[model samples]
Target: MLEIKDLHAYYGKSHVLQGVNFEVGEGEIVSLLGRNGVGRSTTCKAIMGLVAPHGSVRFQGEDLGRLKSHQVARKGIGYVPEDRLIFSGLTTRENLQMGIQKMGAEALWTLDDAYRLFPRLQERADVKAEMLSGGEQQMLTMCRTLMGNPKLIMIDEPTEGLAPQIVTQVGDFLLEIAAKGISILLVEQRLSIAMRVSHRVYVMGHGQIVFEGTPADLEANEAVRKEWLEV
Candidate 1:
């Protein structure tokens, strides 16, 4: 239920996202794929309002362009940046607790739910976040955002720098998220996981969408992969 139209963003004089357009339907997993320096991350930042946007970003029919990042989160959108912004000093459990958006409001996700998704989090419940391994930290970051019970979550490069086994866990987690009816706008570099989990994929190039299709459709288009996705 997220729609971005004619989106554009700049870093001083440099234009990062130019006339970008896409939408994420309810409970759908949409992946934004491209090689490095192609504005994939910038698109996420612009939609989250961390970057100044020059076009329309609408969520469930409401304009998000003018809103602040926290404001956007409150409007049922959660963002997990590529950096995995976890609280280094907080305990694993405490870091998860920090993601609680509503005290008593009914949420689709809970602490126990998060623990069940990844038992390692429960095992190290009392450990500080900084002490966790890279994969564990990534899992923590994602589960923390889910605590907000977002209608749509935009995760930027969820599998980056993790071990292959951890990457598979992340993929399973994405499927579980979609099974629970949460929409996902996944910005990923790893095509295997993205292709496996995404209902549709969008390939970006030079700050624009170059290809939009189902996973099967994308798999059949070798040229698109060679030009925009493959290194």
Candidate 2:
């Protein structure tokens, strides 16, 4: 559903993403896997129009490079950054309410669906977002983005630095998302989750995709793993 070709991004002359290329098929989970600073996050930002893209970003046959970030989102792409961006002052339910593109608009995701995915959100529905724990904040962020009812969701490091149990929960959540016919472009470093949940994986290095294969292909190729993935 999303295709990026020859994508490049710069931070005032510092080239971050260099001719990155990939595609996320409809209802498929594609993981962008690499270590820190290899430009995975920049790929998402460039696609989302947060960064000025120097190449083609096409979604559902529409060119997205000329669009602004909000415009890109309105095109049905949801982005959940690594940093959990939430309204600290708003109640959990209120924050979720803000993600609705339009009240009672027909969409695949809803507040009820979000609550079913993470029941803890319902338990803390009345609490301020700032008062939640780290994992809770992460869940809230993902759910709030879901409230937008995106056709595709690009999540950056959804399981970063959380407890193992929570990490597992996040993995299950990803599976559930894919089951709902939503394409997912997941930027994840955790190999187990990526391998388990992703239909295909791309290994990036020095701001370009160096490897692309199924989870089994990745597991069998120790050389590629050691070169681009293993730390």
Question: CA lDDT of 53 in candidate 1?
Answer: 94
Q: How does candidate 2 fare on TM-score? A: 0.98
Candidate 2 all-Cα RMSD: 0.9
Computed on alpha carbons, the lDDT of every model, listed in order, comes to 0.95, 0.94
What candidate 2 gets wrong by more than 4 Å, as runs, is 103-105
Writing each residue's lDDT as its tens digit, candidate 1 over 139-223 gives 9999999999999999999999999999999999999999999999999999999999999999999999999999999999999
Output the number of the lDDT-best candidate.
1
Cα lDDT of model 2 by residue, 195-228, tens digit? 9999999999999999999999999999999999
Off by over 4 Å in 1: 103-105
lDDT of 2 at 115: 91
For residue 166, model 1's alpha carbon misses the true position, in angstroms, by 0.9
lDDT of 2 at 160: 93
